[model samples]
Target chain A: MTLSEKNLKNEIYDFKKFYHLIKAFTISTNISCKAFNLNGEKIASFKGPESDTSFCKLIQKLNQEKNYCMQSYIYGGQQSEKLGEAYIYFCPYGLVNWTVPVIKENKVRCFLTAGPVLMHEVDNLLVENAVKMCPMLDKRRKEIKSKLSKIIVVDTIRVKYLADLLLKLAKIIMAEDAVDLNNKHELNIFNAHLVENINEIKRTYTLQGKNNKISNFQEKEANLITKVTSGDKEGAKKSLNQFLGYIFFYNADNIEIIKCKVIELMIRLLQVVTEVGVDYNVVSGIKYKYLKNLINAGDFNEISKNILEVLDYLIDCLTPLINVKNRNTILIAINYIRNNYHKDINLEEVAAQVGLHPVNLSKMFKKETGKKYTDYLNEVRIEASKNLLLRDDLPLVQVAFSVGFNDQSYFSKIFKKIEGVSPNKWRVLQKEQKNFN
Target chain B: MDREILNELTVALQKGDAIKTQKFVKIALKKGYEPEQILTEGLVSSMNTIAEKFKKKQIFVPDLLLATRAMNAGIFILKPKLKKQLFSPIGKVLIGTIEGDLHDIGKNLVKVFLERAGFEVIDLGNDVPVNYFIEAIKKFKPQILGLSASLTTTMYGMRDVIKALEKEGLRENLLIVVGGVPITESFATGIGADIYDMDGTKVADKAKEKLKCSNF
Candidate 1:
């Protein structure tokens, strides 16, 4: 099914022959001709006024009578007999009929038909018929003669030989068409399969990679900023520091476009890793001090000292509320929650840990995160619970307890309530669905 | 009489006194105190206090870095002799900047405090890709995998390391802790990363508490 360059070329070559044959027939017999392939695309035609649809309709008629009339019609040449079947007509202007069936695997894949030729070569035939049909045709004699002159006699021998050649050529065309189609089909299948896997692999790496790259930049940026701000001096010293800061910060911008490109390379890297994964720590670190300077010069409020700000910005493009004053209470609360999320802890304990009354801390939590204190606590707990669930060796009860719930039953209830499924159910579904390997 | 020496030792450490740091360590060790204890109680404690001051902006990263160097100088002099009985480490940690990323300031700061807080830290340097983390995990076999990413783009490499570790059956043996600018508790949770914190100073204690948990 894979499409190689060779098979494609052969199909094009076959189509060219079809085109030439149609043109040659038009010249030889001076009859308007057309060839429609199986898909109803007009592959060859000598019709100037007639549309592709007209030829397509004729082919359909020929196909319907393929069993009864195909052989007789091709052999009849210019003298083909016509019977009433919704397709046959005896017009003075022209008579139309099939040449031969272009069979593939014994089924017709295409048809060659010549049509709309003058039935009688006499100059007065159209004029006489038009007068019988309509008086206007008497005035249209020159036009009728011109139309009749275009319909010359069909040489029966040449017609039969050309039909035979076309039939054989159509067979070859169908064979090569099948080969090319199979190649295209397979290529499409392969591309879809590979593209799907590549996408999945890329998606997996991009999320994690974004976090790491952003954090690295944040840490490095902070360090350089700290260096510049702490060593602040007037005039030349400030300019030098600002210049260095600009260089460092600008490096982060330069890194933006490379993110997608590096992600592509990492996808390939991930494929290799999964195949024969390694376990080795090789430090190939790049120094980014120059990039930090650019960041320091920018309004510090636009940046966050917390690595997560950079991470959030890079991953989600979050614009955190810029503030001149540091939210120390939030920092303290966050630190306390992070340290004690796994322990048997509560909002009061966290409030106590941050030296705030429970009510005030609750309000502060909501103010900072737009959620109530207990909601934040539960959010943290459920988040941790999900991680523990991945470690299947841990009992569901233990996993629940590990994330701060004292009662396993309560943990399961809340976990299901938040996750919309019990921990065990979540674990089971996850296991059944994803190998995670 | 001993009060004078203790006061001078405290002042020397507080004032970024390198020479006094070595002298205080030598004198403290000579006075029947263990070198490891001197490191834990004197050298590390001073750095911890210095970190707090730095956090308050009273001291800067350079001042903190200088203090840590002073602390390291003392530790270096004491480390070989006290090799058999190193201070009860806060916890054994395998920390690194994830691969394809080279920003190391946050990681370095975390290392300073985590080590100062009596943890044995094996810092796999910046731009450490997933393979490095896996390798470090296998070699050091630390209970915690502390990953740092400075670039939002490269931070996702942590997931690769996480997956690699999981595939290797190493996740169960280790608590995967992540920190960086872009990393979130949600992201850590999303990727099944164990512990996520915003600041390097907090990461050490968070790792400590997590490691202490029998379940972790």
Candidate 2:
């Protein structure tokens, strides 16, 4: 079912609120529960009494299992039959365990189970009753019951909220249809805009070596030109106070380099002014100086204005370039790569398609991401191979080819390089682990 | 053989006319002027004009490249004659595009600028591995090491290369200059780079500043 934008947004909002609830419950009650997949993939879990990586991994394993079964023991004559594909196997003392299925479209997508409760209360009547009943807990029964109760209470709320959030998230994901939405118009516009600005900066730098000598001003002007050109306004102001020093060094032809430098500085200054997005007053002081210099030279006001306008435009162009989100580009590139992994791809072609030079693109891609293009491609291919390897139904050669590897041996070589084992070995390991579990 | 031929040579080099540059260089040589004088006065200045125009935005990369080609032509004619009187090395610099990056345009620009600015730059080409940079550092003992990484991922290679240099105690003695698209002043600071330039032209200026200060 397609989800509208409004529906997806609502779901996300609901899910966020639900997460807060879970966070509060886990903190207050000291109970821990988690949502897992049928194969034991623990999607989300509250912090247990003792955090263990193996326990987490085991939860993931159980979530991955396709079959759903429930079995409970104890409680004497008050026996409870499983209500769903999974159940909440709660002990009387409040410590709870068991996986409850979260179903969507008749498929057991997620499981919510709560356990290890710690009940915080006065340990008088309840503690006495627990000590009398369930003789297995007779030794330190009060301590066990109190801890168990708290753990169960805290954990159950957390799991329930988690399940609620997961259900909301699923609805949102189903609604948003990320793959389709990402390909929509607005994102494309944003990407294009980013590409344009980057291209412009690159083109300008290539065309204009970042140096130009202003060959006109006096020494005072020359020094001012230098400071301004170097993007140091305060220094320019400090040195400008010594007017005689400038006049003594005034050489018209010698200052050509300084003149060119000032114009370039003016351009850079305009870029900064626009990006600041402040009122004209912020730059009005600099603007006045620029105008005064022109006025002193008897240059037309119209000419100065025109030049400033162009400078402003150039500066405006740079903001998008500077602010271009690296993550977005990497995300787009990842999506593109995933779709086209089977195709023969190279940095030059991809860069061209993405509107970057082959070298710059390679550099940017590597810098933004921690992997080279070839390595990233290999990672995706390896991941695909892993999923295929799990299926005993698919032949090794066929699985390799299906995942875009031309030769099974070459695939095995790269797979071993990445996975640190042969594909068959990896498959066997996975199978053995499954059987053991 | 006339002074006019010298002017023609300059013009040809300025316009990046390689054939004309070669012909003019041959004529000037036949006229018995010292090749070294001809090189410094004619070819260098001729290329200087092109570089100036490049700096002024009056010429672009293709124009600069073509002029460089012409400058090379004149060099071909004068090379043998100037062979005995080798150009004194101003300073040794090891330059390369960092590992995982193959963009050499910026690296090449920096090399050319350094050469013109009187530094003897050892071009290490593109996609240079960390070990190679460290090896070059050991072998050349350059005063400055210019590392160019156009990609973000490849820039990490700079850290590794620097670490290797430090491991060998070379980093203490050497000046590290970095430049590229993804590199920023903040990033340079973060990475403990001695100098960082946003572009190739700025790389030359920053290199000069670093060399002068030699604070490291």
Candidate 3:
């Protein structure tokens, strides 16, 4: 199916409101305008009452080339899409015509075509050109000239202004493109500086390197999964943002690749959190909704927001995993361990906090989360220590003590056991992967 | 040859960067590089790639227009320096989007490429009427006239301008180059144009060839 069919569902992409806006736009501008969907079908149009006998309508009616008008509009729209701006071109009838692509998430949702009107007066020379433009105009020269003279001649600059306004309207029309559409009217337009655009292109040109080997984000990905699994929502969000920025910069102008990367990233993140004894039905339900949202994401920023939203929800669901619904004592025990893992807290302390015996807490934690209580706490400390280890200022001994390990050698032992490499070696792998060129 | 700067300039121009193109041209100039080398190796070479991509749909018309603008930015810096060389300007060409035609992207691109090819081009911009072309031809006395119209309804405007040029007895030595979409080789002949380039990319070369052959 087409992109429009995939995303422009009635609930998500509103058309009724768009029709009203375009109608008002045409009436206010006093210019005849038509809108075409992504498939180039005429979705809606408005002919101001004053433009009933517009030169375009008469010319099309009189001419034998029936599809020429539509063809010209389609060409103008396609050019505007390719140009990424308003395309001002002449119509087949030698009249001023222009189109502005209504882009949602950098995809053309609709095209607003605004003309086929005369920019000049109906002078004798113009009439002569028209007379030769078509054989049907041979006998209708006087009428054609009279019809053209009656239409309002918009100033060239004002026509450009109208085109810009039409594009703004197009943006508004596509505001529903966001999954969370309530406050998403803050759309981007070329109403900003060209310098910013060039700089953006420049940065992407640098980051998109010859093959994106500038840096490997393996450590960052490990850092993020730890945050998610350990229920560090706030830290996970920061990591997610940084991770997305790196990937987006690394793969600019190649959004399909970025989207695929995001899909893989999000599924891995969800997998890490959902492996707990959360109900299978609930996990899949949330998974389906968020994955759909990610697939329908329009831009990198939107993709980031979509994944963050899911993270917020899944993490919130994590908070209540011990509630009256399941009375899940294991989650309470795990939450207690997450809070005190950086300190020298033990399973008895966590069991007492959740009002369970030490033996019961340990057994439930292992049964539900599939990890021993001590092993889970060590994983949390190791994940936390990984963050501190990414910095050079923090010495290894201090990193071990800060993450609740009593001795530096023991921190190294656990880190090596979980990661198959020492912390020092992991840092070297990360530091050495910076290929700036 | 400072091939590195030239390569970066090519990449910047291909990416449609005006400021970066200007920056590279200035850097090369300050480094004592020849303006001709920068023009041919940097601007013209990138534009040739753009034209090839445009034909293959790897890029679009707006990309070509932007690359042309960047090339123009480079030339704006290079024009004065180019006067020291003998290929500064071999001939003059008058070009426009023709009467009632508003699409100037194609026209601007051809103008910049011609200017880089050592031909001084006088651009009359969009919607230029037949008389303006006739008057510009009389005043500029260019060896060629390039008529560009991006729409079918208006491309035939070339015929009227050609007829007017012939009527004024200005077609004898003037090579009329008609271009734009919907303008095929047959249509070019039908419209009385001497050259029928789909795009005016090679009009400058054709103009030079005809000028040399006819000894105009």
Candidate 4:
């Protein structure tokens, strides 16, 4: 599904609402429930009063690893669709679970699962097989055996009835959500139209003109392109912004024309970088695609932002090929920083490795790289930390320590100062953006 | 009937106090005020004020959203009562964010404005597939269809939906309006859309204009 579709689904099947609904149901019925997308990714789950059964957890873990639960959901979805009702069956764990496919326009969009209810006495043979399948369960043998004894049993007819009732309730909730969304949309449009009319009136009187200083514009653009090809990112960024400012000021009335001019500028910049030995494939691949996106940009601000990103990419791509006077020393220092960022290494050690005095090395680094030694080291560490943060398995403190910051608080403080958000928030944003994209 | 109670209800709605709005709605109903009177004077009047404030830049998106919530709180109570009376809408509209686009805040805002303008709106929700749009058009038989897409990649879906509508021989029957971050007037014209707006704020007026032109 597209990001918009996922968002709509999210809005329709509100997580908090579903969580509370399932929680309330669990409280009343002692039946745990979970919702999953078509991919079997658990959207939300609620634990019932009976959820702490050790045996159930073990079986669930095993089932997750083997994808037995997801398989059952898929099978159940097929059955539910075919029969035009919810599908209920005994899982491999010998507990009854029901799956309801939320069908829209003949497509199964999501599934609701409610179960792990024992319809009969727990069989000892099933337990033995589960234990054998997972030897780790041997350590919890006594706990599992005891929990197994406490398993509640219900009649098949009652279980089926409860499943059917829950499915109907889920359907009703979804329908109501649709109505609520429609209502909200209507209200928003009503408010927005009035604002738009006033803005349109104000815009009608705004004056716009073209800059007659087009004589030097091309020369200045060429210089900026040259800077990007030489890997002068800071210079290129400054020039790009100045050019955008000129475009915005002069062509404010005609966004489409400005968009066209910006695309032309980007293409010229790409050609210059490619001429400077940046791979043709890389430039060609992104140039037209980025140009298309730039052309489709909504307004001056969006177009300028896209152009800036393009310039940044060009500079990054050309940086390795740009020949610097102190390339050897800087490369050695950079290599050392990359390799030992996780350890306590000072500028003195790095300078000594490069056979230069610390003061001379620091000055040389700043002059050549446009950043101080400490800042450069921090950038390298921060970059490393970003990679570590991408892995959901790693805790924030571990990520900090793994990237050489012994103090998690200091690490988080530095991260926020650099990234504009806390480490955990950044991780979450990255994950959410990654999921949607 | 005390006019002050209706005034208080309007204030609650403007303040986005859902609980207070609901309370005042009940109070107005209990005071023997007709449901239609309460809706027009209490809820709709507050919404109009909000819309004007929004137009003058005195309030923004969050404020608009909250005010809408407040109005809905009152509307929910009045809906059942108003059902007993004849409450004909201006026209019906079907709206959705196109498939592969997850942006609906804009679309939702449009839906709200159209409804407030007395149009009966059927929102298909975001990331709606082309076939679903076709199916909805056929089922709702709306006077207008609004398609929204925020991403360049997904904006193509709007054109696809338009094409699908034409394929189903349903294109000429209804007015097609397209909007979103990436949608341009030129793009809309190229795709044979009847109207295009940059945002939801102007959609209601544009829809009204289209309806007038089509004599619907």
Candidate 5:
């Protein structure tokens, strides 16, 4: 459903109760939050009586140009909207803040920006930069310092956790009128880190030489069916790319020949994935959608891109069945992790949801998944973040924050420790690899 | 023989010190350093370090572009000297952005990458129409033609150029490599392009491989 159908102003029936709810949030977390409409006017802001955030309000009240703060908020909101999540960033005043966009009909109708906390120690340089916009602050340096000290010092991990919670919180405040606000599920681009596999296919095609004919189709289809049934979605897609690459290579000048081959292959795949044991209508729905796509495909290149999308959809439809049928606790937990890895989900919460003690969950998870819970979650987040890195328009910080990392520095450190190169460098390396033979 | 001068040159380049880097290159040349030695040690090695630093996030894009400018300046002082040596260009490449697209920074980067890899490049610049490409291809008869387009609206211009080349019977021996923001392998092949590479730094390698395997 489109977000405008449930719009922002219609979300809550009672403002007093909502204000108290947001106030409770501040009391527990020691962070201040303000929600704003599209025109840059405040809709709701709750300040806990126990803590003070006169620092930012004082800046807006005293500053010459009030638009800088709003501009930063706008920029941050645009970024979060792009990534489909909350974006944690350092504001112009060097305070850690996050913006979560509540989009409606593709426009940000409202947004919530939270946090003015200190991640690092406040210093003279930071204080000077913070108040440089106001000449009256020349005498108020001491006052600013004391107020900055009053701001809470938060760790990056806790910041990310709170921001993840705040994302849901923002949507909750905006979606109260809708039947289901969580329907906007993001598909995991299943061919995660397929750089090596894509190149391998190219190398194999080159090694197969221009003169060698694919004398038979049975061997190739068998190879793909093995991957698909074994739940190796990436391997299945790799086989598909390899299969399509050969067709395109051999028939570069003939679109009709390649289309004929793709149609024959799609008929075979319809039989293979149909065995997944979902309902008849569901399988038929998947069949109708994919068949229509392939039939409407314009060229061999279109087929190459769409077939991967088909695999992603089919896997999305079928994997739930596999997980639900198993009813294995470890498998269930892993499935849960895969679905929610983009959020700040922790072992304790997953354990609670799955009805296991935290310690047992940790032990069983390690024994089953062959890694610690944290490692697996981090790897999942890292794999997903790798997809975002390929887009040059995205900043390193936003990719980190969108994938549940709070600090760009820490993201780089972890990325290097895991991927052996920094994120941007890894991107450059991937682009350097030959994509087509 | 002061090897330390090359070290100083590298530091200057990484710092994006264009004047100091050129000064060091001229000084190194006057100190009787071989032109090949100065090119590799003072210029190429510094660009390599910048790439390495960028990969490690020790520096960022502004730093990288600044260092690239510094290295380009050093190359300005060193190119004529290198021509005196036995080293030579490996092949010819004709490149341009398609019509209605004014973006050329990516095209320029690919040009730099191809030049550094020793392919002689004849740049037709940006917003180029079809006939200019055909005329250049006929004149230069380069081994590869690189077509770039940043906008979806203009990317189809690459296809139009390829079709025009085929109509003129010039598509037989030429390899067409397509790239830019909107140009994917699918779009490349959809338009009958021979290769699609997004990375400027490695397009030269693909060109070299194609050249090696071809009759030319």
Candidate 6:
């Protein structure tokens, strides 16, 4: 199941119990912390000594007004869970906020935000403007000013470390709660009810929007499907999100219309799958199952999640076919290396040409060709040098330089390593073989 | 002799408690249990269970590695005593990761599995030069030479080793087995290797098969 569908909000997390556990942590660290659901609703909080500072209050007010909390949630939540890292950013008020996503089942269910801690000396003017924005804090101006003087400035490294620690603790708590809920059928019912209520509100707003601006996303859809078929995972996700955004933009609050549009999109995707030569039965089964999930999806997120899952499955099915693209990349790299064997070439340059990380390219190069990047390059250069060496008068140093090597000694060393003889010995041996033939 | 101590040794090996396994072996030896009986019933039998679980996907790489360590600990204590026994290994095998490739996890797993299956394994370790492999084969006179290279770049090292053997006329004297993530059966065959196993557990079985076919 998708993480959002896990109903983590309904999982009986005792805020009082958690607050008690982390109260000392917040106080000692001088960092105020809060947890929020995916919808930007605060679930619980731990106020540190600096929390009541006028600057802190002003920053919180500005965040609510500017929707910075929601922005941070969206920004941090977008990072893939596989990376297992938290997103850190500075709020507009100049205080650093670290957003740690609590991911479950490979989806972010909630976020633990720790911050308003200064990463630098407090800026008085920014603090003044914050106070001006929230005039209700005028009475506490003297106290706020005093507190801002003692503002705790933490290093970015420490902030990140703490954020990771909180993330681990949150994961442990979630796991423990999930295990506890396994035996509680009544709690499951309550969680299902809570999810239904949340989904009901989403469905109501979804159906209320007008259907307009449904442009021809057909070209974009086809591009997205191509990316999926080619096993461009990151590219496919980006395109899918953009395509879904366009669909939601025009057909917001309309589940029935969105469902039909999604089904149409699926059919187009299925055609691509068939062209890729995935088993017919598997393709049909996936299409049927995805359609059922899409139609029954309660919210936009659910529908999007279902679509992404189907895309992921199709990408997996197309993995063997995707090797054709990898083969092309390897061929292109090989050609580049061979054509440029007379000059300098390295893994990084060739990797950039193929738009892959050097390490990944290195691994792929070895897997596809059974030769290391440098080894292949050396082989090409050595072969070229052999042809140059055939001439009776070509100097060995010039031969080395002509085939991309800077030093005759190094080139000779590699040549002997591969051919099991020095260049001069190889020349004499080749001539001997020639006379025998 | 208390049979319970042998059972405890098996459990300790399964749990990957190397020190505990060694202690239990010492206890079993002091209790007048035959070293061969302890080796087979306690250590090898536990590795067999672990291998079976690994095949069934009940355990993973880390678990197998730990179990191997515990089994090795128990076997280390029994090796001296086993030397005096009339224990003949099924075969001798020399193995190493090929030159310019430092990956050895796969090679180590294969070596451990082979040793567990009663083969005398001479591990040449990672980044072994082609000359080292040839020299080791000559010195060790092993029936099988296993070449492992995880990188695509170093896989050619396997081919080079095979060619070197052929050049020295030693190729016919030994069965060459090749393995690694990048070494498929086709790649092994292309390199003229006698056997290829994707899973390290099956390497021992393949080695045995090759030995039987050659009437070793």
Cα error of candidate 3 at position B188, Å: 3.6
- Model 5 ranges off by over 4 Å: A1-9, A12-21, A48-66, A90-95, A103-109, A118-153, A170-185, A188-224, A227-265, A273-286, A294-437, B1-216
TM-score of chain A of 5: 0.51
Report model 6's TM-score to 2 decimal places: 0.35
B203 Cα displacement, candidate 1 (Å) = 8.2
Error of 4 at B161 (Å): 1.2
- Can you give the lDDT of residue A105 in candidate 1? 49
Per-candidate TM vs. native?
Answer: 0.27, 0.27, 0.33, 0.41, 0.44, 0.35
* Candidate maximizing DockQ: 4
Interface RMSD list for the candidates: 33.9, 27.0, 17.9, 17.2, 9.8, 23.4
- Over the stretch A1-437, how does candidate 2's per-residue lDDT look in tens digits? 12133422332335454355445544554445554444444456665444223322322344334222221222110111112222333333322344433333333344445443322232333454445444444576545444434322332244445434433433343343322322232222222232233334444445764442123224545565455433343454443322211211222112233344445556455555555453465556556666456434321112323333434443444335433545566677778779877666666667766766777667667977878888898899899888889989999899888877888899999999999999999999999999999
Q: Lowest summed lDDT over 10 consecutive residues: which window, candidate 6 chain B?
A: B60-69
Give me the runs in candidate 2 sitting further than 4 Å from their true place.
A1-437, B1-90, B100-102, B150-156, B198-202
Better of 1 and 3 by lDDT: 3
Query: Per-prediction RMSD in angstroms?
Result: 38.8, 33.4, 20.0, 21.4, 22.3, 36.8
What's the residue-level lDDT of A336 in candidate 5?
Answer: 89
What level of docking quality does candidate 5 show? Answer: incorrect
The segments of candidate 3 whose C-alpha lies over 4 angstroms from its true place after superposition are A1-437, B29-37, B44-68, B83-92, B100-120, B138-143, B149-154, B179-187, B195-202, B205-209, B212-216
Q: What DockQ does each candidate score versus the true complex, computed on alpha carbons? A: 0.00, 0.01, 0.03, 0.09, 0.03, 0.01
Best by TM-score: 5
Across residues B1-216, which tens digit of lDDT does each residue of candidate 6 receive?
559999999998888777788899999999999876897688877887886786566764345555665676677788766542338988899999987665565686677667766789898987799999989988999999998976434666788899999999899869998887545554577668898865666888878887988974
How much does candidate 1 score in TM-score?
0.27
Comparing 3 with 6 on DockQ, the higher-scoring candidate is: 3
> Model 2 residue A115 lDDT?
49
